[model samples]
Target: MSNPYSEQLSRLMAEYRETQRAMVEAQQRLRSLSVTETAPRRVVSVTVGHGGRVEDIKFPTAAYKRMPPTELASALLDAIAAAQRRAVDEAAEVMAPHMPAGVDARALLSGDVEASSFEVPQSGVSDILRDLMSDPGK
Candidate 1:
């Protein structure tokens, strides 16, 4: 007779391995992520890398020099913020499928919540193992 429990376990294990592989791929893509944003009238441009780390900035034109110091600063800040927001949005989209249902990838990346708060549920694992061992044919 076929062992249904064994078949189920094998299927689950295969799924787990596939999920791990996909997550690794997603992480690799995120690591290489970069985004650039330019402020109005090209006052400033900023490039951000993974996790929104500022990688580069350029005035792009003489317009920044003509602006007041405060305005220039504001333009730089705005460009950097826009770049970071784009990076976070792209990252969230890439990671959404790997996250559990109802988990907010954007909120997590934006630092709105602790990663520990999204800990994977542990209930099914133990229950499945117990059932498998208790009944090989179940």
Candidate 2:
């Protein structure tokens, strides 16, 4: 018996190589992706990398001078959040094909609780609202 398991070993090795190739391709695709988001009123724009790092921010000085500080702050927050969300979605897409069947890759990557899964047994609107509005430290 000259390496009786040679065939099986060869097949496994091929599969391992294929998986590595796919991983490299996916990494390249992810690295090339950049999420660009704009603030309200087109006052500011931000480009975020795959890891949610801000790569660039652009806005005309006039635009900044026109908007109030509070509005500008809100716009910055919104744009940054949008960029982060895009990164999460793109990463999910890249990882989805490699994930097992029936597994939600996006949800797994984001670690976000689905709103529809919330259960308030026998709780009325008033009760739920009160609870939500209440102080969390109590």
Candidate 3:
């Protein structure tokens, strides 16, 4: 006995397979992308791969020699954070066109797409200034 619904189910399954293939390809491309960011005064720099992995880090010779261990550690942390933020921004930008309308790319990259769509949050000037003034350690 042939079921009429069988054909429709097969077609749906084929479509799902194609979509999954495309998603895998997109993830591969994203994994190859890289972003680099440097801290203020060129004291520290970091590079991050598309998979959110840190690829490289560099510190100025003078900065490395002059700063105490704690300060150096703090600077490195700050540089890494800056690089991560830049990497996330880059990922969002690359994924924007590929994403569905109203989808948030950052959220998608963060594995938060299930929770919410992509929406870039705006940072105020005052907020930036306050962060700049605050101690990096704290």
Candidate 4:
């Protein structure tokens, strides 16, 4: 005889296993994620990897050599920023499906999401503590 409880348990286990597999795959993809961007003046290019860290930088032209130190630094910063933004967008896309509903993956990847926003109000904590401290038999 086919047991209904066994069937349900089997289905649930299968779902759990699938979820685990998908999450592993997503993490692997995220680990390999990268994005590249170039400065507007084409003086510098930057490649950003996971966590928005710069993996590589390139100067496509000798224009940077003639530019002032501040100008060159600005161009490098701009390219890095652009690459980081694109990397965050890509990471958000990869992570959003794995995250729970209403979670903003883009904001999270960009470091703009606050942990406090997810906190639940403990309005009854004091009351509960007071009740616990009082004599129950009274």
Candidate 5:
């Protein structure tokens, strides 16, 4: 007779394979993602990848000629920041469904979601310790 658990095992295997395939596809999409943003006056455009690496920048030569160097630098930085934000937002969207419940995918990417970073306030800890020391019998 066939094993009773065989059917469940087969179904689970299929689901695992599907999840792997989906992860691969999502990774490819993220790698190929490029967010382009323009400055307030459309004087500069910046393109950044999903990892926030600068991929390209474009500013008209005529505009550059008339713009102050400080303004140009600020515009470049603003455009890059805008593009990075867009990339992070898109990555968060893509990663959310795959992440565990209650996990912030964006925070994890920024190295801010680690469990070790969680801390109880020192004052709270001290209060608890004081209470324990004062009421050892309880």
Candidate 6:
């Protein structure tokens, strides 16, 4: 009889290769999309790209002269968070059309799905690595 284990390993490897290609393409697509969010009163705004990079920030004149420093800071932070959420959503929207059916690109992009869930851990690699490397493993 043929070795079924070999066939299983081959299939697993093929799946892994496909997933890697898909992820790289998704990342590239994300880098191309952009999203922006602004404060409720339009005093602050932030623009972010699909790769979660901040592309720009805008502050209205009134924000600098009328608002206290702490309030201005708070509004900026809120706008950044809003922009990040929009960026993630936009990234998902762009990726949705390209993704395989039933795959949740948003969860993967947002890191809600752990990479470890898909791969095996090698104790040898961890045991021999620096402490800093181990921190990322957790």
lDDT of candidate 2 at residue 89, scale 0 to 100: 92
Give the TM-score (vs. native) of candidate 5: 0.75
Better of 3 and 5 by lDDT: 5
Give the Å error, residue 89, model 5: 0.5
> How far is 2's C-alpha from truth in model 5 (Å)?
2.5
Q: Among these predicted structures, which one has the highest TM-score?
A: 1
Which digits, one per residue and each the tens of the lDDT, describe model 1 over residues 55-90? 999878899879999989988998999999999999
Q: Rank the candidates by lDDT, best first.
A: 1, 4, 5, 2, 6, 3
Better of 2 and 3 by TM-score: 2
How many backbone collisions does model 6 have? 0
lDDT of each: 0.90, 0.76, 0.72, 0.82, 0.80, 0.73
Q: Global lDDT for candidate 5?
A: 0.80
lDDT of 2 at 106: 75
Give the alpha carbon lDDT tens digit for every residue of 49-110 in model 5.
97999999987445766788998898899889889988988988888888766678888776
Please, what are the lDDT tens digits per residue for candidate 6 over residues 1-138?
765445655766797799788878877876677788888788887888866788899875565568888988998888888888778778877677665555676887787877455544354324434443556443
- Could you give candidate 4's per-residue lDDT for residues 43-113 as a string of tens digits? 99899998898999999888888999999999899889888888889989999997766789999777788
Q: Write down the RMSD of all candidates, one decimal each.
A: 2.6, 17.2, 18.3, 8.3, 12.1, 10.9
In model 1, the clashing pairs are: none
TM-score of each: 0.84, 0.73, 0.59, 0.79, 0.75, 0.59
Query: After superposition on all CA atoms, how large is the RMSD of candidate 3?
Result: 18.3
Worst 10 residues of 2 by lDDT: 120-129
lDDT: worst 10-residue window of model 5: 118-127
Instruction: Give the per-residue lDDT of model 3 (tens digit) for 17-101.
Output: 9878877877776788787777766777788887668999887556677768888788788878777777787778767766766
TM-score head-to-head 3 vs 4, winner: 4
By TM-score, the better pick of 1 and 3 is 1
Question: Residue 110's C-alpha lDDT in candidate 3?
Answer: 72
Candidate 6 segments exceeding 4 Å error: 1-29, 118-138
